[model samples]
Target: MNEREVLSNYVYQIVASLVASGVEQVVVSPGSRSTPLAYAFASTKELTLHRQVDERAAGFYALGLAKATAKPVVLLCTSGTAGANYYPAIVEAKYARVPLIVLTADRPHELREVGAPQTINQVRLYGENVKWSAEFPIPDEAPQTLPYIERHTVRAVTIATTAPFGPVHLNIPFREPLVIDFKTQLQRVSFVKSFTNDLTPSKQTLAEFTSIIEQTKNGIIIVGELPLGTDTKALWNFVRELKWPVMIESLSNLRTEVPEDCQVFAITTYDALMKNERFKRNVRPQTVIRFGAQPISKFLMQFIAQSNPLHYIVIDEDPMFRDSTHSSTHFIHALPGEWLSEIEISHVETELAYIEFWKTADLLAADAIAKYGQTANDEGAYVQLMLESLHEGTDIFVSSSMPIRDIDTFLPVLNNDIQVFANRGTNGIDGVTSTALGFSNGRANRKTYLLIGDLAFLHDANAFVASRYQDCDLTVIVLNNDGGGIFSYLPQAKVEAHYEELFGTPTALAFEQVATMYDMEYVKVTSKEQFLATITSEKQQSLKLIEVFTNREENVKEHRALWTRINEVIEQWLDML
Candidate 1:
């Protein structure tokens, strides 16, 4: 076979293997070295190709697709800094455990150490961020080469979608002749498929856990960030049976559409109440059962430390130690769904005083917060309005930093089925827009909403250039606080000398101009009624942006005063204990 035929078969076999392994969608960024793969992907009818210009946005776009589908989505980019642009998304996919197959085309071995243009050390570039990385052999006619290509492609998909799914890398090197022959169809070879078996706990394990539950009366369950589309029926039944004080994180997808009876035990206001010196000192859990990752609240983390449960159990199917407190006494390596569905539970007879106390404190804190969020014209107030305005079965993607923190504190348990998503893996603010846009492609995307900070919006505007959202009914609500609003709450705010120049680095850009540049309908919400009306109104455009301007200083003061008020209310309640 000639060079053209060799490259054609290699690329075609790789694409077929990806399909065989269950990659339904692939996002591609045009580049010279990746032309062969792009053509192969575009030519195949089994795969869907999304052409994007910016590699950074393209990377995050793939991440969002993987998240929405709960399957492995392939990402293809050229060598050099283009692949490096994918680093942030790769890191997020690592922590978030989204399965992404990154295929980066690189220069051949001859170009290395010669400082070739558009070339860098492409081998294992993502480092520890990926679960596994493989460097493909150059296109050749060696008998073993084709088999290796076929098996490795399937293997990459298996590793990516296996237990604790995450990103995987495949660096393909191509020489000057990057084009493929169009005369003959590329060879599509067959490969083996991969499957992941569910891990269920044994009867002895279940009995032991039951004993732990029966012995302890004041146990608590902490549900953190769960995977998207996790069937929570089993989890809900477990929570219902336990009737423990469950702290539901914003991304857990547990609080949305929860039963009113279950919501009584859900202490969503713990972030506000945990800050109280007396509450933290007095309230304690004798046993703690944690599921998923750690919650995004530092105050809650501190409270967990203060609570200091003696019989703590963390559950996961992988080797990861999900307990950040390092105080957990047991780790169960079983899938949450599998064990939660199979476990047998019989409630132990005890007084309902422990959970009753939490129910009262939670009500007081929630009342105080609702009053503050009523008409304060603060960011939290805007967020509260936005959360309430979302329709049932809608998807809301929140950005990190202040946006997520606000959602965590201000959002109350709702009966509507509103799914919440965030990039809290690394908690970076870089690709909030692209991830949301990517998520907006699958089911129920026509009513997708994004609650983002102003800086995150400006930083990721490149995602709009080549994005072709299928339904495109995306409503972006930007909290335009000018600069980093979260920084004002930290101790660094006291360093007023360089705070404005350094931390308070405001970008005074008229977002209306940005809306004009992107051809999106722009509306600046001024009053509380106007903001609520704008978000709840009919959707006429493909993409509409609503910017609510706020003050950095005032937001800090507003958040503190609300917390103080909550503390006062909770303190009064805790005095009886």
Candidate 2:
């Protein structure tokens, strides 16, 4: 076989192995060096190819697709800075545990350090962010080359989807004639690798855990960021059996999954009520059990640190240190669903005083939030209204800064079937719009909603390119505070000298123009009633945006006032107790 034949067969085997290993979607960025891969992926009948112009946007798009589908999505890009653009998404996939297979095309071995155009050190480019990295040899007719390519591709897919799943990088080097012209019969390769492992806990460990739970009268369960397709039913059963107060994060998906009758144990307003020292003193958990990633609420973290529970247990499948407060006393290396399923809990009769206290406090906080809804221009109230108005089985993608914080703090106890997602791994505000669009593409049947702040929406404006081409339903709600509204809540707001110039970076671009340029329906609402009507309207297009304008300073005041009202309600409840 000639060099071209060898290269063609190698590329064909790689794509075939990926398909055989169950990779359904591939996001490709146009580039010269990646011509072989682009054509191979396009020609494959089993793979769905998505073309993206911007490499950065493509990276997050693939990440979102993988996240939504709970499968490994392939990413193809050219060499040089194009591959580097995937760094943000790779970092997020690393911590967020999304499965992605990143393939970057590169020059041959002889071109290293020769000042060749578009040539850079692409070996192990993502470094620690990727679970594994490999440099592929130039395609040749060696006797063992085909087997090596097939095995490598299979291993990459397996590792990417294994326990503590994450992104994997494979740098492919191609010589001249990057394109494939002749049609050749592709060879079939078998994927014989097994990546599944049973993580059943030992009997002693379960007995010890049962003892801990039995001994503790006042305990709390904090649920944080969970991976896609997590067995939320198992978690709900475990928490229900424990019969403790549960503080669920917005991304936990448990916040909305909690049944209506169980609202007494579900503490959705802990962020507001934790600010009251009197409430904290009256209802602090003696033992705290946490699951999944770090919580998004800063107040919750502070509360955990200050409480200094006797037993702070963290259960995670990954080995990473998810505790930012460094307060975890025991770390259980086990899958949450598997562990909870194995442990058998019997009914235990204990004093109902502690649980009743937390239930009363939660009710008081819920009442406080209900009263706050009478005021307009409040972001927290808007979040509550938005969530309440969403239809069952809606998918909401929240931006990192204030939008996610608001949802975390004030989102009510919902019984609707809703899934909330965010890029909380690194928590940067870039590529949010693209990620949401990709998620919509993956789950084409679901109606998607993206709640983004003005700055984040503007930063990822280019994401509209994909939205224009892809046929998906997305309702984008832009919270336009005219500046970095989150900065006003920080301590730097007191720095009256340069706060506006430095932290409050305001942009004057009209979002209606953006909507026009992107061929989206735009509606600017000045009142809460209009905002609710616009969001809940049935006349939304393929891509629609609703812009809500508010004052940054007033937002800060509203948050403070909401907290004060919550404190008063809690104090009143305590007086009755």
Candidate 3:
């Protein structure tokens, strides 16, 4: 067989193996070196190929797809810096435990060190960011090479999707004359059977954990950012069965639609209520069973760090360490869903006052925050109003920093069905729009909206060039605060000398023109009522951008004032105690 035949056969089997391993989506960024890989992936009938011009956006695009579908999505890019562009997404995927298969096409081995054009040391380009990285041997005419390629490709998918799931890199170095026979058929496609094992805690482990739970009524449960489609019902059932008040962060979709009777058990306002120093110091629990990644609230983390619960058990499906407080006394190696559904956690009812104490405090904080939002006009009320009015079953992708924090504070607890997503893994603001766009693309039928800030929206302006969302229903609510609104809440705001130029990096871009350039309908949101009426009136099938102007300093003052009011409510309750 000639070079074209060998290349076609090898690439065909690679794509074929990926398909057999349950990969239905492939995100490809075009380049010359990756011709063979791109052509083969495009040729495959079973795979839905998504093309993105920006490698960075493409990587996160795949990340969002993997996140939404809960499956491994393949990412293909060219050699050199094209592979490097995937670093941010890989970091997020690794830390977030999203499954992604990264494939970077490189020059042949001899051309790597010799500085061939478009060639660099693509081997281990992503380094430890990926779960596995391999330098694939150049395509060969030998019959045995087919089996090696097939098995290696399959193994990559398995490693990425397994527990502690993450991205995997396969660097393919191709010689001159990249494969051109797009119609070349595969000699053989083989698939090996594989099974997964759930890391369930043993009887002794569960008994010991349950013993701690039964020992005290003041036990707490914290469920952080879990992967999409986790068995939230089972986890909620498990928490409620224990009768322990649970703190579910915004990223954890389980916080929605809590029954009226069970609403008291859901602690959704720790960010505001924990602001009261007295409540923070007084409301100490005996045990803290945390599931999934670290909770997003800084106040909550500080509370846990200072309070020092007796037994801090971190229950996670991933074996990786996510104990942000670093005070975990027990580490249960079990998925929250699997353990909650599989194991029988005995009903350990607590003193009526214990649950009522938390219930009252939560109700007070929520009421105070809601009342403040009624009169306040800032990013908080903007986010609060929009989220509250979202159509049920809307998938809203939230950006990092102030947007998520505000949502954390103002997110309505009962009868809410909106699923929130964010790139909180590494928590960098880059690619915020792209990930949301990919998420929109993944669930195209669902009414999707992106809640982003000014800087984050501009940071990924390149995201539009790489996406085909011009026709998609992606309602982007760009909060044009002019700068980093979250920075105003930090102490650096006191550094009047350099805060504006340094921390307050504002992008005063005309988003009306930006929307036009990006093929989106621009709507300037003037009032909360107009905004609510616009979003809820009629749903459009095209991309829409709703721009809301705000002041950075005003947003901070608004949030602090609301927290102050919530603290007042909290302290009044404590005074009665």
Candidate 4:
């Protein structure tokens, strides 16, 4: 067989194997070294290929896609720094438990450390962020490296798609003999099942956990971030029926059936209460029931530590350190849905006044949210309006910093069906745009919205270069307070003007320039009126950039003013009683 035929067959075999192994979306970054692999992925009809120029953005884009789909996303890049560019997303995938399969093409070992163009250490470049890492040797016609490639690809994808799922690395070192023909038929191989089957906990494990829950009173259930399709409704019903003081994280998806009696504090909102003596004493339950991923709050962590609950039950399939509560008593290695079904709801006695205490606190919070709504310029009001305008089942990828916090605090989820995602594990602004783009890959049938900040969007501007979201009805609403709006609410802002220059770091880039560059539909709104009008408008074929402009300093003042008013109202209401 000709050399091109051999390589083409190799390509066909690789792509077919990936498709058979359940890899759906493959993100390909353009480069000469990766031409064969790119063509292989794009040529196949079974797989979807999202073409991106910037490798860094492409990597995060794949991360976002995998996160939303709960499937393994394949990332293809050429030799050199292209592979290195994926490191950040790889770290996020590992920490966030998203499945990412990285395929990096490299020159043979002979080309390494010898002034070779676009070449570096491709071996284990991702550090501890990858679940598994392997390098495929140069294929020789006789006993070809096809078997090795197939085995590693299968294992990497399997590990990434299973529980505690994470990113995996595969480096293919090819020589001059790497060229392939288009028409050659490559030999195929069966995909090996590499999933971990020990997900079912033993009977003894269930009994031990049941004993803890039965004996514990004054317990609190803290649900953090959960995986997609993990059956949150069943868990929500169980917690509600149990009448436990459950602290629901925004990403937990446990906010759907929240009871109106108000034992649930909406802890993400009243962050300042963590420091208040009366607030802590009144709201801190004796135990905590944690059942999701890590939350986005340092104040809550401190509160958990200081309040020091008697016990904290973290029920999750994966045993991860969910928080710094420093009091995880029971790590139930079973799915929340599984565990909740076995236990029946029962009445437990604590400080009997605890329920009423939280009830008063919830009323205080509701009143504060209502009053804060009057000021349409603040972060809370912005979140309220944005969420109210969105429809059910809209996939929203929230940027980590302030946008997520504000949503957690002020926005009442209009629809429980609206899927929400964020790079919460790393919580960095970089690649947020790319991540959203990656998530738009297979969503031609659905609408995807991105709630981001001005700075975060600017951080990954290159992501909009060539978007595949044109058919996906994608919209990006950028809250342009010009900088880190959330930082103004932090203690650093109290230090004076230095806060603006050092921490907030406001910028004045026009969103129109970016929209024009991408040939996307754009709208700039300076008030709530324009925002609502644009949000309610019909969805378009092109991606839409809705920029809401506000002053950073003023936004901060507004947030602080709202908090002060909340404290005052809560105090006066208590006095009336």
Candidate achieving the largest lDDT: 2
Off by over 4 Å in 4: 257-275, 344-353, 413-416, 468-472, 573-577
Models sorted by lDDT, best on top:
2, 1, 3, 4
Quantify all predictions' global Cα lDDT against the true fold.
Answer: 0.84, 0.85, 0.82, 0.74
lDDT for model 2? 0.85
Candidate 4 residue-wise lDDT at 104: 92
Error of 1 at 486 (Å): 0.5
Query: In model 2, which regions exceed 4 Å deviation?
Result: 346-350
Per-residue accuracy of model 2 over 290-313 as CA lDDT, tens digit each:
988889888888999999998899
For lDDT, candidate 1 versus 3, the one ahead is 1
Q: Per-candidate TM vs. native?
A: 0.95, 0.97, 0.97, 0.92
Taking every candidate in turn, the Cα RMSD to the unseen true structure, in Å, is 2.0, 1.6, 1.7, 2.6
Error of 3 at 451 (Å): 0.5
lDDT of 3 by residue, 26-90 (tens): 99999999999899888888888888989998888888888888889999998889999999999
Quote the lDDT for 293 in model 1.
Answer: 81
- Give a tens-digit lDDT track for model 1, residues 1-577: 8889888888898987888888899999999989989889988888888777889998898888888889899999988999999999999999988999999999999998798999999899999999999999999989899889889999999999887889999999988688887554545666655656776777888889888988887888988987644677778888888888899988898778678778778889988888888766656888888888889988887777767787888877567857677778887776678467566666664349888878888899988987886647789888888887778888889999899999998888887888789998889999889888888874443468899988888889877865453344578899898998989988999887899889888988758877887778889987788898888888667789998998887888888889888888887776766
Model 3 local distance difference test score = 0.82
Q: After superposing candidate 1, which stretches have Cα over 4 Å from the reference?
A: 182-189, 346-350, 444-446, 468-472, 575-577
Residues 273-362, candidate 4, lDDT per residue (tens digit)?
A: 453555676567667777778566566667777777777677666666465556676677766565566654354454446655655666
